[model samples]
Target chain A: AQSVTQLDSHVSVSEGTPVLLRCNYSSSYSPSLFWYVQHPNKGLQLLLKYTSAATLVKGINGFEAEFKKSETSFHLTKPSAHMSDAAEYFCVVRGNNQGGKLIFGQGTELSVKP
Target chain B: AAGVIQSPRHLIKEKRETATLKCYPIPRHDTVYWYQQGPGQDPQFLISFYEKMQSDKGSIPDRFSAQQFSDYHSELNMSSLELGDSALYFCASSFRGGPAPDTQYFGPGTRLTVL
Candidate 1:
């Protein structure tokens, strides 16, 4: 079984400040991890993915995440927070060598404070 | 491309009624998946279709059924709607079959309301 846990249900950050959303996972095998963003009334957009490649994966919109195997975590980070970055973020884990079902975290609602 | 396209952006139905949602996948894609997103919750997998065949069915109930067309389009049919069935139904498409790493593109989703 595979599961993901997002530590924060809501996060607030000031503009131009560094942003971090924490996520942890439990999987039996090596997993494929992904971060997806969903704007209000919009569909989910893939931000980044880690597929057993580089531990540090860069994604769209100047966002990135590091896959930390020892910690069992993959936390999303950004250097500067923009107003447009306000959205719900989901950390997903897909079981390796199994069916292609994705297990999603509870989701983090990011609020950009001006 | 156009990504995935779903029909009936909003639907309302009474109890014991049936609802059908349609989806057209992106061009050159061979896999389609259905997901349900409840309020304030993450999306849950409903079913998946690959090569016009049912690849996997999730924890959905027996009242829910799905079909795929030769053109890679798909339909999700729900019978005997209940209030719990009210949610956003999303259709997604991917390029190939079986564990492909390609990101699934999602449709706008249909908001179903059961009365």
Candidate 2:
């Protein structure tokens, strides 16, 4: 079984400040991790994915996340937060077994304050 | 190119009535998935179809069923609607049976409300 947990339900950060959203996962095998963003009244858009090649993954809109195996965490971060960055973020994990199904975190609502 | 497309962007149904949602995956994609998202929550997997075969099903009830067509288009049927079933339903697709990592592309979603 695989599962993901987003540490924060809501995170607020000022524009131009750094942003961090934490996530932890439990997977039986080497899992493929992903970060997705959902804007208001829109579908989910992929931010980035970690397929065991790189520990640090860069995504669109100046967002990035580091896959930490030992810590069992894949935390999303951005150097400077923009007002457009305000959205709901989800951390997902897919198992390497047969019939791979994505397990999603509870989600984190990011609010960028100006 | 267009991503996954879903029909009936919004729907309202009475309790005990049936509700059907449709999805059209991107051309050439062999996998399609259905998910349900509740208010202020993450999307929950319902079922997945790969090459017109049922691959995986999650914790949804038996009233929820899905089918896939030869062209990879899919439909989700709910036998009897319930108030709890009111939520946003999303359709996703991905390329399967390849070396490429499985990345799902999602549709705008259908908002279903049961009265």
Candidate 3:
């Protein structure tokens, strides 16, 4: 079974400061990882994805995640936090045997303070 | 670029009632996926369709059924609604022949409230 675990349930960061959201996965084989963000009462938006081509993946809104195989981690980071960055983030793993069903983490609520 | 579209952005229903949710994939998109998200919870995959055929399913209740139409649109039919079924339902679409075939674009989602 492929699953993702988000280390933090909530993370607070001041505007212009660095932000980090940690995630780890357990998979029997190589996995396709993804980061998705959802604003209040809004649809989820894809932030980034890792398909094994590159360890470092860049995404929309100045976000990026590095897939570290040894650590079984794919942590999202931003050089600077903006107020609009406040939202819920989910780490997802696509099941290899389930026709690409996404297994999601519990989610990390990001709070960007101005 | 056009994105996925879901109907009935908000819905209120009573227990034991049935409901239908519709989804329209983006132009040229042949794959559709559905998910359910409870309050303050991560979304869970419910089902998926590829080329108008059932492709995958996960955590979907027996009372819930879904199908993709010939036009490539999809519908989810949920029956015997319970309070636990009150949640946000999302529809996503992707083009299998596109460069980024695996990338899914999500819709705004339908918020269903069962009373």
For lDDT, candidate 1 versus 3, the one ahead is: 3
List TM-scores for all candidates, in order: 0.95, 0.97, 0.97
- Selected candidate, larger TM-score, 1 vs 2: 2
Question: DockQ (Cα-based) per candidate?
Answer: 0.59, 0.82, 0.78
- Which one is best on DockQ? 2
Give the winner by DockQ: 1 or 3.
Answer: 3
- Candidate 3, residues A3-85, lDDT tens digits: the string is 99999999999999999999999999889899999999999999999998999999999999999999999999999999999
Residue B112 displacement (Å), model 1: 0.7
lDDT of 2 by residue, B7-102 (tens): 999999999999999999988888888999988878998999998999988877899899999878999999889999999999999888656538
The list of candidate 1 runs beyond 4 A from truth reads: A96-99, B97-102
The lowest-lDDT stretch of 10 consecutive residues in candidate 3 chain B is: B95-104
lDDT of each: 0.89, 0.91, 0.94
After the best TM-score superposition of candidate 3, give how far the Cα of residue B27 lies from its true spot, in angstroms: 1.2
Residue pairs clashing in model 1 are: none
Candidate 1 lDDT by residue in tens digits, B5-86: 8998999999889999999998888888898999999999888888898877787889999999998899999999999999
